[model samples]
Target: MTVYIDDAVHPWRDQRWAHLMADTLPELHAMAAQLGIPRRAFQNRRSGAHYDVPAPMRERAIALGARAISRHTDRELLKAVIANARLQYDATA
Candidate 1:
């Protein structure tokens, strides 16, 4: 299960943040845990679970096997994430 973070870089609330996502929620959680991110920090997005990871955490996540996305902006990334969620949701239907 590969994990991808949207945006090569982003700024949020004074500091930069990146959108982190995975093919599955469990995969996402496992990667986040490896990066020492607390479970409470998980961001509950309509497109699976996401987390606005700081730059440092983003880098660490990448180093630990998460893929860093650089081609799309936040909106585009969000669209993809949502699509993935819809697919997952539909498969269960």
Candidate 2:
């Protein structure tokens, strides 16, 4: 079980953001709590269960032990992580 933060740095509302996902919902929520992100901020979409972390917080997540994954470089692992996240969402839903 591991937490993954992607390098998808998309810009929104003038801040860059990335997706924070984990092998399980509990792990995902725990990391979000550690980052001071409220449970309400969790994105529970069918796309994938995740927390959107801003650019600066992305670095903090890495420092706190979240595995950094790049869509460009970690295609397979990223897919597996996302698949697991979607499964987690389905289980809870």
Please state the error at residue 38 of candidate 1 in Å: 0.8
Please report, as a residue range, the 10-residue window in candidate 2 with the lowest summed lDDT: 84-93
Candidate 1: the clashing residue pairs are none
Q: Per-candidate RMSD vs. true structure? A: 4.3, 1.4
Error at 32, model 1, angstroms: 0.8
Candidate 2 scores a C-alpha RMSD against the true structure in Å of 1.4
Per-residue lDDT over 1-93 for candidate 2, one digit per residue giving the tens place of the 0 to 100 score: 889999957999999999999988899999999999999999998889999999999999999889999999999999999998887676455
Report the lDDT tens digits of candidate 1 across residue range 1-68.
Answer: 67887663667777878877888878888988888889988877445557678876777888888877
Q: Tell how far residue 86 is off in model 2, in angstroms.
A: 1.2
- Model 1 gets an lDDT of 0.73
TM-score of 1: 0.73
